[model samples]
Target: MNTFGLVIGLITLAVIGIGAFWVIRGERVLGYLWWPYFIGAGVLLMVTSGFIKNDWCSALAGVIGASLVWGATEFKEQAIRAELGWYPFGNHKKRPPFAKIIQKWKPPNL
Candidate 1:
C-alpha cells in the first residue's frame, strides 16, 4: 500500500541493474570495499527506520535497506568475476591491494 516503498524499491533495482552492467562490462569503478560499505549503510538505514514517524517512510527505508544489502552481495560476485578475469581489474594491470585478499580465496578455474 505504500507507494514510497515501491518507488524506492524500483530505484534501487535500477541502480543495481546499472551496477551489474558495469561489472559485466569489466568496469570496477566501485571497488571491492563498496559492498561492505553498502551493507553498513543499509544496516544504518534499517535502524533509522525504527525511528521514522510515517509508515511509508519506514517502509521505504526498510525496502531500500534490503536492496542495498542485496547489492552488497552483487558487489562481491563482481569481485569474483574480476578475479576470474571475466572482468577487468579497473585501472591497474595488477590487482589493487584490496583485491589481494580476495584473490587468495578465488578457486583455481574461476
Candidate 2:
C-alpha cells in the first residue's frame, strides 16, 4: 500500500489551513500590496522543488509553494474583509517597496 499519496494529501490540507490564517494576518500586518512578492516567492519555491531529489521534500515544498500562491490571491479579499469589519484591521501595515507603482496595478483574483 502506497502511503505517499495519503501523506502528501494530509500535508497539503494542513498547509491550506495555515494559508487561511496567514492571509488574514498577513494582510493586516503586511497589507495587500505584498501580493506580488508572495506570488514571486511561491513560484520560486515551486520551481526550486523540481530540483529536489527526495520525494517527501519535493512534495512538501510544492505544497507550501501552492499554498503561498493561493494565499497571495486571498490577500485582496482579506483586505476587503478587514475594511468591512469582518477581521481585525491594522492601521499601520508595512508597505512594499514601489508602493506608488504597485497601487496603480490591479491585484490578481482567483
lDDT of 1 by residue, 1-110 (tens): 65865776787677667655744443376565544556677899999999999976787777677666666666666767787887676654334445656556532122
Per residue, candidate 2 scores C-alpha lDDT tens digits across 1-78 of 999999899989999999999999999999999998999999999999999999999989998998899999999989
**TM-score between model 2 and native:** 0.98
Off by over 4 Å in 1: 1-27, 82-89, 92-110
Q: Model 2, which residues run further than 4 Å from truth?
A: none
Q: How well does model 2 score by local distance difference test?
A: 0.94
The C-alpha lDDT values of all candidates are 0.64, 0.94
Instruction: Point to the candidate with the largest lDDT.
Output: 2
Model 1 weakest 10-residue run by lDDT: 101-110
RMSD of each: 5.4, 0.6
